[model samples]
Target: MSFGAHRPMSVLTWLATPVLFTASVLGLIGLGGMLLDADWRVALSSALFGPAAAVTVLLAGFVEWRTVRCRWCLGLGYPAVVFVAGLLLGDVTLSSPVALALGIPALTVLGVLMRRERNRVIPIA
Candidate 1:
């Protein structure tokens, strides 16, 4: 949960999920609002928050690497969990079920490979 001061990561390992999760939700809201023409402010939020989701996720994944028991969960699942939460909270136009149905396996495989590649490159201590 704690990344000691020496490591110099922007977020704590535990906070990554929540930060990404919130960013996803807020980004969705901004995007939805922009598309709906609900408010001009949403445009800014969309620009700021949307990329934050990706950046935060990648930052957490590569820079602040942490291991999870399930590779499927590690690769595809974390994003899925936060994204689903985003959809629900932001009330985005995209259908969570439909997106997830198609995305799950592909992303899981990607995640697994990512771990495998890291294993080969980094090796376990």
Candidate 2:
């Protein structure tokens, strides 16, 4: 079970997942901010390059690695969670930063738990 053969593919798969997740998160937040009177550029800038975005991506990647062993499942499912989170939080005002801040970690953890439970109930082999 050498990881070498899968190393490149794994890295590539892992990288692509988070990038899209980050972008989707940022887009959602930015859209919310804009709806709340913030400049679109500022909102986008705040999300596109910041500690929060980095942390979200990093945490999501960790969840993907730990629970969703299949890269393809991770690539699809992880973003879907974030996507729903974003939509649910779409109306959150910018003043309430805590809600948005908590969403990333909360949803990431949820995805991890759900994936693990799924694997337990229905083992692949």
Q: What is the TM-score of each candidate against the true structure?
A: 0.31, 0.29
Instruction: List lDDT for all candidates, in order.
Output: 0.44, 0.46
On a 0 to 100 scale, what is the lDDT of residue 112 in model 2? 64
For candidate 1, write residues 29-118 as lDDT tens digits.
555554576633322233333454455455454443344543335445554555555555553343443333333443454455445544
Q: Which stretches of candidate 2 lie over 4 Å from their true place?
A: 1-12, 43-125
Candidate 1 weakest ten by summed lDDT:
5-14
Tell me which residue pairs clash in candidate 2: none
